[model samples]
Target: MRFTLSALALILTVAASSMTAGQSTSGQPPVTFTKDVAPIFQNNCQVCHRPGSIAPMSLLTYEDARPWARSIKQKVLAREMPPWFIDKNVGVQHFANDRSLGDRDVQTISAWVDAGAPEGNPADMPPPRQFPAAEVWQIGQPDVVVSLPKDYIVPAKAPDRWPDILVDPHLTEDRYIKAVQIIPTKGFTVIHHIRTSIVEPTDATLGSGKLDDADVPLEVGEQGVFLNEYAIGKQGDVFPDGSGRMIKAGTKINFQMHLHATGKEDTPTNVMLGLKFYPKGYTPNHAINSTTVSAREVDIRPHTDNVRSDGYLTLKKAARLLSFQPHMHNRGKAECLEAIYPSGKVETLSCASFRFNWHLNYVYADDVAPLLPAGTVLHSIMWHNNSASNPFNPDPDAQITYGQRTIDEMASAWISWYFMSDQDLKKEMDARHAAKTVPTSTR
Candidate 1:
């Protein structure tokens, strides 16, 4: 048979790959799904990519993954599929729940695909991973579930709706929550966001922010204390051990619902707030709280790009920052959190690329969590893109303002942290310094 030099080289390459299927050619074994790729997917991708999860496709087995091998390689190479969008070029690289792929992971997947995506030895496959059913909560069942008395209807096509739906959970005394979750009890696809807050008996909100009961239904966040929130990528919040959020007695939940029509009328729509509390009379070592550093007024001109907005919060008490959760609607591009020390030094703690679909809480690892002194300024920098080139922007020609709708824009970052005493802060920082400067033995 006649063959060109390029075709001859290609055949020889394939033959070489086939001969080195099991053994390493030069200290590097041939990348295969059974041995190398399966474990990576099992650890990083299978949580969501498996059946009964939010991922669009399943990758639990070679049969399921082989079809999408090329797509998988492309997504990981672009650092897009796993949905952890932190900019690796900057900021603290360690996180408690980071799902992004590492350099070796990318190389392994790429090599497998380029080498014909072999399945390798069937006996080398790892055991299947177990998971809870899709309907179960990630944090397990709660001690109490506060939900809408009835479902809220979402029309097939209409303007987005943000209504203050109040729910009463009878409690004779205060309760300390260990973990909390907010999820749509019925319609998951139609809702845009859900922000729930604790409204005490003497809340300052105008009128009764109650559903279908107040003359003007005011939202809870205007004055009430935040309890928890839910969006696309935010599954729930589990406070650290020995930490809890307090819900006082005689409190009502101002369950503000953000409903957007999904082109199909959804009538069976409701939300549920699940609370798992610590044992009674068990107080926590730290008092936990959360707040947002949000720009009061945001204006984005039509066809604009890299629109910047800034907000600042100075610490009155020494604090250890817990987590950084970026919140923005469509057209939101990127956000950063910086610590401005009183000594005039600025340290960029974390910078992340934002995707409106994934409103994630980037929890800093315990050891790497920033321990800042009092009066340290938390500078929140937010950028928006209103230009047509932006794929997620709702409208390229419309002027955007700071409002609650999907089309309108807002710049806000939700942060969870606890204020610490000066002495505790000093102790923590000194230990960290010591750890860094500790001498190692030559032996």
Candidate 2:
């Protein structure tokens, strides 16, 4: 009886050991590339962290990402890597390709790093993601490319200088454009501000064809319509349908290049404009338009801090806001943008601790889907620095006003919106397409 009991016990012990070994081999968590980490980087960090992206490092490959796994975990946990400025819990702002990491994602990554970043099970790895080549236009090939006829020289000096140069690209016939993009060629060191305007042929009196060589600069007149405005290292503004200021047939595009002689002579500068035409048969669902919601001019009192300027624009009727871009030069302290709907619900658009060098066009996903009824008000609040410690402060001792030169200050916000009704959008799109169909008239 004793011998039989001993044999049974030995058999039971062997069976238990076999089961434990099987569980260890089969139940180990697989470090899947797609199911685990690739999706995290693709959704949260790819926009700026991919190859040739603005971010300092690339996380596109397992090898490339392995080295930065610890850094990624640390930065994400600290809420610094993604650079999101809004309070995510309170507002519903979402970027088209957002890099903001959630708590669970961060934890998973940290655990993966602790588990040796194992490239476990090669079959579970995802296929490599295809990234677009750099310099390729996001909106496809442009129909017309307009560049400066010649390079303009900029002098070496400390004080800000505004050079109003005329770039006349004389087109023989009328052309309808759907989108326009500006690319800077040179003068990055000295350039501080630029405003491009369309000068109709009939409005020759608006600007003399000859360059403004005189040391005494001419102020931008009130009647002049701004085609586009840009600062250093900023993305080109894209005007929606019927949103751009028109350049009539035989008209010349004029540029007001604001070159701030940063105490050093800069290489000659040139700018290029890529124009995209409306598609042949497709009708646009909405026409894009821009309106300022902040004060046009601001006066920052000397020796003081946190000078605030608030501006609001009430919509005459309901409209769907597609996207918005906020603009502010150096000395910008802080900014908060929001929209108050007719239902008394306030939608927080964006809030950021202002970083002057990094200007981004925050594109929303799904047009925000907010039905801003009649009497909805869009609001923007901008804070400025007028203290001695502000590094970009041109004149901390003097009051500032809205001006083109970098030394002089300005406070303005531009929001681009698509019209309310789908029918109205379709009409504008059809008109644009029809205009393109007409035969070119060479007069």
Candidate 3:
């Protein structure tokens, strides 16, 4: 939440400026793989495009990329690769983990392909980047790791599975958690998402080593504190400095696993969630909180191109905003978040050009986090396109509503923040106002 984005900004900026810094600036000098495109892929695409990852093909090597040169050029030109959909021309464009390609990089790749996709001298290539192993912990080792009681079998051709498991950490004392990472042992290939919550269900036999009901999502009142979630391309949860989420001593961890079918024979998986606790006796300056604002009630007319819905939430107390994740289904077109202050002034917090396939979490830079006092209402607006023009839309003639399947539509904004006192909130507001008056560069 409070991390610097200078590194990622540098990656985007330098990749743009370096292309024309000392070169002829005349005729482009025959852009080639080693000389032009490799570094761009290394910094931006290899994370998900490599082996054992979610992407269908790897771009880590020249041989791997040569076959897909034209396709790569097309995707990048369309701003579809690297899977970043934040509207660059819209609200707060600087994010901590932005992986979108710069215009210059895209141009470079296009030119390289136009010139027959030449392979420059191998000696000119830079050192290959080192990525964490597929099964290794993204954040270092955790304080404790808990796994599912038994491996769950996912049939080859079945409806989407929502297998819920109960995990009890059995803590004798309250623990302040700094981070949590959920890893799918053998199900990463077919796993859609994994959500965890801290709950104290009244049922005494819940965590009795048996799979819970699949319709657990409908029971909102029984759900506990929102902990964290894991989806494709999401690097686990690591709280900013001086912030933590508390867990009561007797609380049970509820694991809601969403497994998708890969069209293969029975596959088994044992998912795990790792917890990193803060040192004992250390109190955090702020307590992290999360809320999922969803507009469950929606009526989308058949063949509609611009169906819209708005979900609203008004805060009870002051809090410092940390991050946001805007979600929608296949027909989703765009997502936006706005803040309406007590004075009736509205400010755009963040907006992303939504794509159903790539669900991204946008974490704001620490310096940009605004302090919202009581009565500040947050608006989450989502736009959908269920017409024939939308290639991802499964059916353009059926009215859509909120349901558990992907074909059914959903509109939600998962917001994360930390509670702060009024006095501290004022200080943050003052700092934000003072910083705004100064001239700033556009993203």
TM-score of each: 0.78, 0.58, 0.80
Q: How many pairs of residues collide in each model?
A: 0, 1, 0
Cα-based lDDT for every prediction: 0.75, 0.58, 0.73
**Stretch of 10 with least lDDT, candidate 3:** 208-217
lDDT string for model 2 (1-443, tens) is 53367557655754454343223245755444446888788766765666534455777777778888778767775566676444343333565534457656666665566566655555656676665443445445777677778887776654544556666676666554577766665765454456666665764534322222111112244223345555433355455555432344676666766555544455587777767756544445554444446565788788777888877777765565555555566777667777776677776666655655444445555433334555677787888888887776767788777776656665555555544654544454355456643111100
Error of 2 at 131 (Å): 3.4
The model with the greater TM-score, 1 or 3, is 3
Task: Give the Cα error of residue 409 in candidate 3, in Å.
Answer: 2.8
By TM-score, is 1 or 2 better? 1
Give the per-residue lDDT digits (tens) of candidate 1, residues 1-443. Answer: 22265457655664565455434565667778999999999888887676544466799999999999999988987778788888765567788878788766776787788788999999999999875443456667898888998888877787667778888888678878899888776776666678787777765453122222111223334536566777554567888898888777788888877666766465567887889988898888876766666777789999999999987777777888888877677889999988888777887788888887666778888877888788788888999999988887778999999876677887877776777888998888788777763111100
TM-score of candidate 3 on Cα atoms, chains taken together:
0.80
RMSD of each: 9.4, 15.2, 6.9
Q: Where does model 2 exceed 4 Å of error?
A: 1-87, 90-92, 97-130, 135-138, 150-166, 171-176, 179-272, 279-286, 302-304, 340-349, 367-369, 386-399, 421-443
- The residue pairs in collision within model 3 are none
Q: Is candidate 1 or candidate 2 better by lDDT?
A: 1
Off by over 4 Å in 3: 1-25, 138-140, 154-173, 187-193, 199-226, 231-235, 249-266, 279-283, 405-407, 433-443
Least accurate stretch of 10 residues (summed lDDT) in model 2?
Answer: 210-219
The candidate that wins on TM-score is 3
Candidate order, lDDT descending: 1, 3, 2
